[model samples]
Target: MIQNNAYIELMKETKQLENSVSKISLRLKTDQQLIQAFLDGNKESIGILVERYQRQLYFLCLRILQDHEDSLELVQKTFIQVMEKLYTLQNHNSFKTWLYRIALNLCHNFLREKQNYNKALSHLSLESSGSFNDPVIQEEQSLLLKEFLEELTEKQRNAILLRIYHNLSYQEIAEIMDCQEVTVRSHFHLGLKKLAGKLKKCGLTL
Candidate 1:
């Protein structure tokens, strides 16, 4: 009986050690490493990758779609698509940008089908206004910024949002946008110039 109890305790300790080692291995894995692991038939690695990026992708979709339900749906669809097409991905290091590209393409297609530009702007305006805590000054500033954003072309707005809100570099933005770096720079700078002009008119500086 004592030997039996000792064997059970040893088994428990071994299991605990295995769990700790698994967790440490997961923590040490980079995105590319996770992707490779998934490709190598470790199904759980894909779930880890999803957990790492799902929140960021959801917010990116929400900012573009401006609807919670749509954003949620898009995030699910994005992951599904990623899982289905991951094998075709040539550059594992570009997984993040590739993921964003998929999500953005889905957003663009949805927006195009809806064809409700004015409705989207209205939603954006409301979101902007609600973001401010100060009832007076912040509200006014938000409204002004919303108006400036409304005037920008789609490419210009996207470039500005990706750069400012996401803190993405020009090269990364270009990769996600599937555009030239120079084009992204032009759109961003032109958008900024327009914003500056609008802010100057209101005695504010960007």
Candidate 2:
């Protein structure tokens, strides 16, 4: 009876050790490893990818859609599309840009179907006018900035958001926007110049 109890304790220790090692291995896995695991029928690998990028993707979608519920749905759609077509991804190193491209496409399709250009401007106008816990001057300046953004075209708005708000490089924005690098630079520069003029006209300095 004493030997049997000792043997059971040994087996339990071995199982615990195995579990600990498994967890450590998972934590150490690189992006490529995770992608390979996902391709090899490991659903948890996809979950890890989602967990890593969900917040940034959500904000990106939110800024584009300007509607919380729609943004959330778009993010989910982006992930679903990624999962479905992940095998088509030839370069794992470009995963982040590829993911952004997917999300941007979804947003563009959604906006096209809804023809919500006016609606988006209206929403931004309403959103910017809301009360904030900042000083009156700061709040007014922010409101003016949003109004300036509202005046820009969709391409200009997207270029400004991706480059300024999200800090994406021009090349990355070009990839995500499906445009040339020079085009991305042009859009960004033109958008900034327009915004600056608007701000100057309103007596607000950025």
Q: Judged by TM-score, which candidate is best?
A: 1
Which digits, one per residue and each the tens of the lDDT, describe model 1 over residues 1-206? Answer: 99999999999999999988886787679999989998898887888888888999988888878999998999999999999999999999889889988998898788889996656754563233133465676667777887778888888988987787778999989999899999999999999899878877987656
Model 1 alpha-carbon drift over 4 Å, by segment: 1-24, 125-135
lDDT of 2 by residue, 72-165 (tens): 9999999999899999999887788899889988987898799985666544532332234567766776777777777777788778778776
Q: List the residue pairs that clash in candidate 1.
A: none
Model 1 scores worst on lDDT over the 10 consecutive residues at 123-132
Judging by lDDT against the true structure, name the best candidate.
Answer: 1
**CA lDDT of each prediction against the hidden true structure:** 0.84, 0.80
What local lDDT does model 2 show for residue 65? 75
For every candidate, C-alpha RMSD to the true structure in Å: 3.7, 4.4
